[model samples]
Target: MPTTNQYEGIKHIARITTNFEDTCEHCKEHFIDPATATNHYIKEHGYKILYIGPESDISGMEHYHWTVTILGK
Candidate 1:
């Protein structure tokens, strides 16, 4: 889960402690803190959903930056 930054700027904050492999499958990077990592994900990969903009996903839209809420919704 996000664990941090649940709604900071558009994020749905969730915390994660297990399933490191799964997280890797989704995003191939790690951060010491939620603020840095989430911010990086948003800036590096995120895209405005429809110009009107609501949800944001990973960098590649379908690959690098996945938008799945598998846990801790």
Candidate 2:
């Protein structure tokens, strides 16, 4: 699927669900893509990357990062 600059790192994640089942913690918006979720926090709000989900050692890149966009600026 096509992604915007906000969610370009979707592919870089080790384990991210492509299903838009996930909901935003702040806006409570549903998205089928993880990138969309990340972008939502970054664009809609003003959150920074506190930490990228730790990389998976067993699977190699299955880990993802959390967008603290809602928690803080």
Candidate 3:
């Protein structure tokens, strides 16, 4: 079985937002929606979407933002 440590450094992440300007963490490109940001990482950055959920840091605020965590190749 694969160990957790083996995957420790293989994760990449990006942030998508509805209220603020969304920037692609990997390529510094701007996206309008979460889907576009997510697709950018997958198709252009060679990353697979592992999890997408509300960013805990900004949770419970008025704005809606999502953190897209991906597995890198």
Candidate 4:
């Protein structure tokens, strides 16, 4: 289900993890931390929704996949 950002009033829920090797889908750059990826998405891409997979997904060393969607047009 799509959830809203309580702080920014955006429409989407962001799932952050300790997975440090994640990358930004927009910029196609690897991030050492999820928060940095999130900030880049918001400050640069203006994205509202960032859905990250479960911990097991990252722990398994699977390919990182983030589904991004912009909210409020």
lDDT of each: 0.38, 0.52, 0.61, 0.55
On a 0 to 1 TM-score scale, where does candidate 2 land against the true structure? 0.43
Model 2, runs deviating above 4 Å = 1-20, 55-72
Model 1 lDDT vs. the true structure? 0.38
Give per-residue CA lDDT, model 2, range 1-73, as digits (tens): 9756655434322223442257766677877777777677678766555444433233475754343222234
Using lDDT as the yardstick, the better of models 1 and 3 is 3
Q: How should the candidates be ordered by TM-score, best one leading?
A: 3, 2, 4, 1
Query: Residue 38 CA error for candidate 1 (Å)?
Result: 1.2
* Clashing residue pairs in candidate 3 (N, C-alpha, C atoms within 3 angstroms): none
lDDT of 4 at 30: 77
For model 3, the stretches where C-alpha displacement exceeds 4 angstroms are 1-11, 17-19, 54-73
- Tell me model 2's lDDT, rounded to 2 decimals: 0.52
**Best candidate, TM-score-wise?**
3
The residue pairs found clashing in candidate 4 are none
lDDT of 3 by residue, 1-73 (tens): 8656435566555545544557776568987776777678788887765555556354565555545444454
29-72 in candidate 1: lDDT tens per residue?
76545345444544655522211212344655563332322222
Clashing pairs in model 1, backbone N/Cα/C closer than 3 A = 1-14, 1-15, 2-14, 2-15, 3-14, 3-15, 6-13, 45-59, 58-65
> Which candidate do you rate higher for TM-score, 1 or 4?
4
